[model samples]
Target chain A: MSLEIEVFATLNGIPDEAINNKTVIVIDVLRATTTITVALAAGCLEVIPVLTPEEAIEMRERLGDERVLLGGERNALKIPGFDLGNSPLEYTTEIVAGKRLIITTTNGTRAIRRAAGGRLVFLGAMINAPAVAGLAATAATDITIICAGTRDRFSLEDFLTAGLLVDQLAGQGEFVLRDGALAARDYYYCHRADPAAALKASFHGRLLADLGMEADVEFCSRVGATDVVPVYGGGIIKKAS
Target chain B: MSLEIEVFATLNGIPDEAINNKTVIVIDVLRATTTITVALAAGCLEVIPVLTPEEAIEMRERLGDERVLLGGERNALKIPGFDLGNSPLEYTTEIVAGKRLIITTTNGTRAIRRAAGGRLVFLGAMINAPAVAGLAATAATDITIICAGTRDRFSLEDFLTAGLLVDQLAGQGEFVLRDGALAARDYYYCHRADPAAALKASFHGRLLADLGMEADVEFCSRVGATDVVPVYGGGIIKKAS
Candidate 1:
């Protein structure tokens, strides 16, 4: 089975037709996807991404607070009354087990909701790039990497992750890349030499630094921290068993 | 002085702040911007891009048919009464000089109008990449590259051109790149090895080829055919002296 990989640098860059019948890999390296991956890897059962903070709260109210942990941010700061902000470090295994997280991040999780129609796979900087790449290769359908860019715009961090994934896949030599996929691979190579420098110089990175989340930038830039690949099937993103 | 380059893979990928205080370069390599650039470089005095054919007719009625040439396409095919379709080959110098061409393209020109608030520039497969790079390098303000993606979605051809422009600017070595600019350059390097393959694999490129415009694809892929850089100032696009 030939798997066609399509890389979108921003959520807005997603093609209308490519959304159908594909396994979509949603990546938001700076925080949202990173936070979710960490939360799940840390032993949180599942995370439900909502479009807005109010929607997260509403979902929480329905699911009941005892089992659900409220998470997310507004302008990179923790939401008021939220049990957690969008920090991967906050999601420790000791703090979150068998709990459902209602999350609404500034860019990442919201992008996840917009891409709800596809068979979704969530990725972040912490995940092993090779693992994500392997998952993409074996998916048996077209792979569309939807970079959950910052605020409807292209983010370098997200695109960089996509590039890394493409790079891993290209090394396998098992798949035929479309132009978008090849482009992603090239982008990864361009920034691979100095990722930290690339991250610090990005628009979102600077903004995150300005918001006092410089630590998040460092955290998200780490490649292959988790072998756990979170797959979104039927609207809920969970660790692939 | 610092020059910023904003790359848009899709109309939706446009950054919020890019709409303000930047010289916007419109790129629709499949056609639109390519056609305009070709027409102007071929000696068309001025090309007025409108959103609709009705407007072209209105302009024709108001400006008189003696000098007005109706151009553009609905689906890569020429409008019923228009003088041209959205093809670079159709814009050869012998036919377009000293003429007022009323044009409406599928994506490129519309994007230019949409982001009209910024200082406007035109980019395509043919002409003035280095000059555009030079202009961007010397520019004191941020530059936005608006890619006329296929049908409100991201097209690889346009994004690749944006990347190439970004790559050239990065090579200039005197300017610091914003994250967006760097991302565009990364995208360029990703697609630079084979522009024809990149274009053929794009959503718009396939559509054009299916409609029997293989020649247009070749024409659109030729880089640096002309050094005349088109700039949109005073609400109309013309050659920047």
Candidate 2:
């Protein structure tokens, strides 16, 4: 039998088979995925995802500070001594051009590290979701979408973004939707009327608002603004080749 | 912040929050949930879900067989000396009428036992998707959907059914879909066009076919055939009053 695609809402929800020998698409739409997608689209060379802050520091040391820039966030705050934070706004072309960024984050990067074996792609609101789904549709292996929710809990922004992506994929021929995919699509449908409002209402969004980052939430919710799909391969994420 | 409703593709994936103070809907469309729904809908008085066949036998002794019936399955076969298997077909009106069933199955029943704390509702393809969603939507507590996947792995059938159910709950206001919920919904959309073919292509379906039970696969795919929503309360499932 051919491989069947499966969608998992969280890393914890992913089954052994969904991870084993499968192509996984990881989404952290509130910030990380969106940030990375924008950074790459804005002409960043590559992003090396590190599991721990210490690892990012070590990578920066090995790669040399002249060529490598440090980028990460802990609890959505910029790490001390880092060149940039986890916001897409901070990853503009003027700063990230021709730079290799060593990045770490609380949830999204950890998920990327855990997903070392699978064929991993990073999706954001900027990318045309249909393009990402099209890439998944052509892959011979089973597809697993892992949403990097906030701190071991479900994040609404990520779920809705994943749903929008899944909704696009479901429109393709002969594809079967699983419960996780259906949940994502339905969630997208539920929030499709007002994505900015949905993002603002999220737990992370409220935290960001408390931290005075309401503009970032609005920016992240704007869909299809960019057409870049950053696929994670080797040890870094680059614009999908 | 209000408690968010998180769904899990399997019992093992349930977060502490979703496992506690939540009204969990456990679904095993390949049969446990479907069979229980069919059994109770067919007129069975009550269904006691136990973790093991041994536990089921012990309860049978205490409850007495005057009205109780031992029911279970292992590897899709009837447990030795049990009155019924995990087959919706066996739960016909004539056989299950007014009887009490003690069930312990491989995947579905075990998931129900592990999901002990919540107000558990057993769901199957038989129930109307809207009704399952309505119960979750109107519940006083947060909702968790525990899909009884095959042997702790992601089973397409259970997840697709969960997606169908979760889709109904979306857009009810003041609700957020978790990663598990998103994934299930994505799965549902992917499979909605041709559910039977989707079921036939699942890992469990292939195994069932190897065992020469392809009929069971087709039988389980029929939606909304039963209206019963078997609520697991007081450690037993009965038609919710």
Candidate 3:
């Protein structure tokens, strides 16, 4: 089995052919994957990723807002009517446990939808990189890590997270890496020792810091802080259990 | 000024919007850019990149075969009846000096045409990396480097060469790097100590060695071996006089 990592600079940059039957890991380290990982680790029932706010609202209505929490952000700010923003800190065990989250974000949800055709899709971030890599390697299928870049441009945080996952998998399996994978592995090796510093240097990181969310950047930079491997299937993301 | 390096894993992977008004550097380090740089450094008047064998033949007809030499490759082998193959070794000063050459390859020329919409396009490779970086830094425009991956698939050689160029430019100018640029720079830093060893470990490099072109790989891997920066303007690539 071989691993081919395709680093999409943005959702718009992902080729249509990239999502066919492979195990896809969607990474949005500046906080969608981190949030999802936290939610699952905190015992959330499932995270339904919707592409639009209306879909999230509709899902909330169907499931009853009491049972389904609406969570997401637009332009890094919390939606006015939503129960929560995209910050991983909000998905604490006290709040998210046993609740279903209908979420939509500026970039992460769109990337998840784009990757729906994969044989299996997993949410990956620094917080749960080892778990995701472990699951992916055991699957023994070709993997494509999609970076949910900010807006329609590349995001260094997401790419670095994907690189971290690639690094983890490279040690466990013999795989044929694509050019993007090789580049990502090199980037991971170069910045592995100082991920927090690397994240702070990114465009998205600076933007988040400007928004008074530097704490979230520090939170998301913790590699393997959680062991939850959130798997996406049947239109919802949930822990492997 | 800002530098945005968009590393396309393949020619098909490049987005149409990436070329607008940017200074684009097209890299095919395994051969095309290496050959072009060598030809120019060896005193060739110009290298006209064509997309097809017919166009090369037509250009030879238009300029007369005596003045225009035909060169390029289809699958690492010289086109039948062409004056030369896509090899830097064949571009010795004795044969190509003072002659104009029309070239086409499986990937490089296609990538150049893909980047034709740029404000200025330049050919780049490990052989002429320093020269290309110097020209790009002096241009002081938002730059985008296009890697001509092999046959619409990621080629490690081209990407690492782009990384080398990015690393060089990053030191010469103050520029905001895009995510891809940062990744490329990291990759370059990881493998800068010995480009030939890095190249030999790449997919295309292994294939070239299998085809008995180890010498070409060695020649192309030389950093700062030539001072010629080949500029593509008016549909022709010539030394930046």
User: Which numbered prediction scores highest in lDDT against the true structure?
Assistant: 3
Per-residue lDDT over B23-134 for candidate 2, one digit per residue giving the tens place of the 0 to 100 score: 7888787878878888888899999899899998899899767878888789888999899888777888889898999998898887887677875554545354566666
TM-score of each: 0.85, 0.73, 0.90
Which docking band does candidate 3 fall into?
A: acceptable
Give DockQ per model, in order: 0.46, 0.18, 0.37
Docking class of 1: acceptable
Ranking by DockQ: 1, 3, 2
Worst 10 residues of 1 chain B by lDDT: B119-128
Candidate 2: where is the Cα deviation over 4 Å?
A: A1-4, A58-64, A119-140, A154-156, A163-214, A221-229, A239-241, B1-6, B41-45, B52-68, B73-81, B119-139, B149-235, B238-241
Chain A, model 3: TM: 0.96
Name the candidate, 2 or 3, with the larger TM-score value. 3
Give per-residue CA lDDT, model 3, range B1-241, as digits (tens): 3455555444654555777788889999889989999999899998899999998898788876587789999878999999999989999999899999999999989988888888988899988899889988888678888877766455778878878888898889887777667767777889888879989888778888999999999999999988888999888898897
RMSD values for the candidates in order, in angstroms, are: 3.5, 5.2, 2.8
Alpha carbon deviation, residue A202, candidate 2 (Å): 5.4
> Can you write out model 3's per-residue Cα lDDT over A177-227, one digit (the tens) per residue?
776677677778889999999998888888899999999999999998888
lDDT of 1 by residue, B206-236 (tens): 7788988887887788777777777765556
In model 1, what are the clashing residue pairs, if there are any? B43-B97
